[model samples]
Target: MNFEHSDKVKELIAKLEAFMDAHIYPVERDYYDFVHDHSNLWKEWPKMEALKDKAKAEGLWNLFLPHEYGEFSPGLTNLEYAPLAEIMGRVPWSSQVFNCSAPDTGNMEVLARYGTPEQQKRWLRPLLNGEIRSAYVMTEPQVASSDATNLELTILPDGDDYVLNGRKWWISNARHPRCDLFLVMGKTLPNNPRHSQHSTIIVPRDTPGVKIVRSQTIFGSLNSPGGESELRFENVRVPKANMILGEGRGFEIAQGRLGPGRIHHCMRSIGQAQRALEVMSRRADNRVAFGKKLSDQSSIRQDVARSFCEIEMARLLTLKAADQMDRYGNKVAKDLIAAIKVVAPQMAQTVADRGIQIHGGMGVSDDTPIAYFLTLNRYLRLADGPDEVHMSQLGKQKIREYNAMKARPAESRP
Candidate 1:
């Protein structure tokens, strides 16, 4: 509940800022150009690897992880690491330099919390070392994935292995050449309790029956780094050893991993919103119309004011959620997570839209990152779970609390 970050987090923030200024910002254009120009979206750009090595050598690697996984993580708590994630969020790809990017961050948490020693040695170690990448194959093309229980992929047991048969879409990281493993969630026992029917199993990307139907685009753009993809699993055989945690426990593992993952995105969105507001403020001050600076214009000033309020509100909410997750458990903080999952992305998207408006024509064009920011932050509203899903869940939780309070013994009321 403390408002200020700990001293260690401040130090990391300083170093992270310096690293971004020197390495990331200087080549932001080149980085995007190199990756976007490739005919194949999956190919690697060597500069990314070099920058990653430099970041690792500087001791910024694996900073997103908590103390429980000291073998590979930096051992910082979620509250301590949120600020660092925000700094990296200023530039979309910057987090990857420190190996703190998503899907990877979430996948790492799952492995640390649920993987067996042998599984960890084979997959988690390489991921920690940045030797490979991964994808979470859960959402299906045929079903309404928002429910998650609607996942229809079959994980049928065969001799010594599990055979996967289904199709998944909007899967991040699936198109990357380095993404060698898939942490797939599917129904192993349809007859079990709805929440307990699904299980997570690790399937190698090159498994015999796997097929990538195509790479998907987000808002008419398929930027590299982590491209959206569609994949088909036709009797893909994976060793039973690849099952994570246990059968009928995929939702449990997912819920555990999602707490940190969702908050991390919120932290980064705050940072992005902060940067967009900064850009907007300067633009208002520097640009002039009708013989007066935009800053002097009431409407422009109001935009700045509104943006500042939203950024502060979103940041505090995220911090509160992280604090709750650390003190209690993710289950206790689920509603807060859902709240931020809805708020943060919308905050960033609004800030991005205002920033774009301030920039006028250049905003929507590739001349600035504003357009991309607007698009991606908007997409985030639908990412982990869409706004409707989270809002509905939060609404239900509030009602439950209200009803419980009303039903309590009269003497218990204040």
Candidate 2:
């Protein structure tokens, strides 16, 4: 019931907010300019490197990891990390500056929790140090990737190594110049139990036959420099020791990796929504339409009000999920996580839509970040689990709980 952030978190939040305002937003223009000026889609942005180094030197680094990870993380719990993530979310690319971006964050967590000692020494340490980036290759274009058990990638054992053959798409950050690893999920033993047949293995990006087919664009925007990647692994060979946790543990590792990732995504969406609302309000109050400010119009006022309510509701639900994850574990908090996962993205989209409407033509163009924010929010609904999937799962779980309660003796119910 206590929703207040701890003092430590509050202090850090202030620092983060100040950093974003003074350091991040000021140069966002230059950053995008740099992105546009680069003809090579995957080339590293030197300006981003400077900002990252500044953030690191200021000790604002790796705040997403739940605990001290090697020598890089700051040991912030899920609850403590949620608001900070929201701050980073305001600027989509800001998280990476602090070494707190996705895929890498999830990949690092997997290494910290389940990787063998040598695995941690080799991959996790450099990842923690921000020396390299990684991609999570789980979803496939050929299958209903929503059903992760349907992962069609093949990982066949061969004496001392495993040969991988599959196509993975929508992999974020795979095109980064520093992307040195891929956490690939595939079927190692198809005859095992549905959930147990899949395994996650570490495949070096440079491994032979690991091909970068293309970088998929969202809404005609190339979103280059490691936005969305499609890669093919044709007989890519990796050592037997590369399997994480063990064979048939993809589901288990995914369970651990995704909870944090979901919360992080939700928190960022909340931040994105907040930014949209801020921009929308400013635009409405300042702009005159039909001889009156947009703020004076009844419809704009109502939409703004609704956006605020939805943003607050989504944020509270996200915090509830984070709190539950901290108190119990991912398994126990899964219901809440699913609920937030379903709510946060839609909330962001709604708010962003209103912002776009408020901004008129400029919103749809690259003149403002609203267009990009809306795209990200829309993608999120389908990213982790589509709206339909989360709704179905949440609905089924609710029905099961209701059925269990109905079967219980009336007096036994709380």
Candidate 3:
């Protein structure tokens, strides 16, 4: 019920904001320009390493990993990491500067929590040190990937290796220059129970038969440097030791990974919505339309007010989910996680739409981040799970809870 951040978190937030102000904001345009440039596709920005080093030197690295992985984690709880993530979310690319970007964050958490010692040493260590990047290769081209049980990739056993054959698309981070690993999910026990049929394995990006078929664009943008890619795993062979957790744990690992990941996405969307609102408000204040300032108009004021309310609501819900996850566990906090995942992205998309309307032509251009915010939030609506999916599950869960409560004796009911 406590709304205030603890002193430690407040300090971390201040430090993170100071770092962002000093380094990230100044080069935001330059970063965007490089990533959008066709010549720099899949190439790491020259200054990215230097920025990351600065973030590391300032002790702002790996703030996303909740578990204490010795020297890798800062030991912050999910609740503590939420605000810092929100700050980083303001500038989408800023998360990488602090080594707190997605796919890598979720991948590292999986390795830290479930990887074998050898697996940790080989992949987790370099990932933690930000020496390389990774991709979570799960979604497939020919299946209803939202329900992961529909994934059709095959990982049959060989003498001492697993041969993977599948097609995966929308694989984020696959195009990064230093993307050295892929946490690939495929069916290893197809005859097993539906939930237990799949397994996740670590495949080296340079391994034979790991082909980059094409880069997938989001609304015509390549999202360079770490663009989403379509990959073909044609007899891709990886050692048995590369299996994560075990043969039947892919679904379990994925569920665990996404709970935290969903919260992170929601908070980042809040940041994007917040920045869009600010940009819109500032534009309204400065622009004159129909003989008066846009800010003086009722519709503009209402748009700002509604956006503020929605952003605050989404942020509070995300923090609540984070707190519940920190105190209990992801399994217990599933409802709230689903709630935020369903709510935040749509909220951000709505706010960004309003911002775009207010800014007129400039809103859709690269001059402002509102256009990017719109794209990201819209994508988020379908990224983790579509709003409809979360809504359906959440609705069912709520009904079941109420039914169980009604089934209990009157004296036992709250």
| CA lDDT, every model vs. true structure | 0.89, 0.89, 0.92
Candidates ranked, most accurate by TM-score first: 3, 1, 2
Q: 328-349, model 3: which lDDT tens digit per residue?
A: 9999999999999999999999
lDDT per residue as tens, model 2, 168-260: 999988888899999999999999999999999999989999988987888876665777888899999999999999999999999899988
lDDT of 3 at 236: 90
Q: Where does candidate 2 clash, by residue pair?
A: none
TM-score of each: 0.96, 0.96, 0.97
Clashing pairs in 1: none
Quote the RMSD, in angstroms, for model 3: 2.5
Considering only N, C-alpha and C atoms within 3 Å, which residue pairs clash in candidate 3? none
lDDT of 2: 0.89
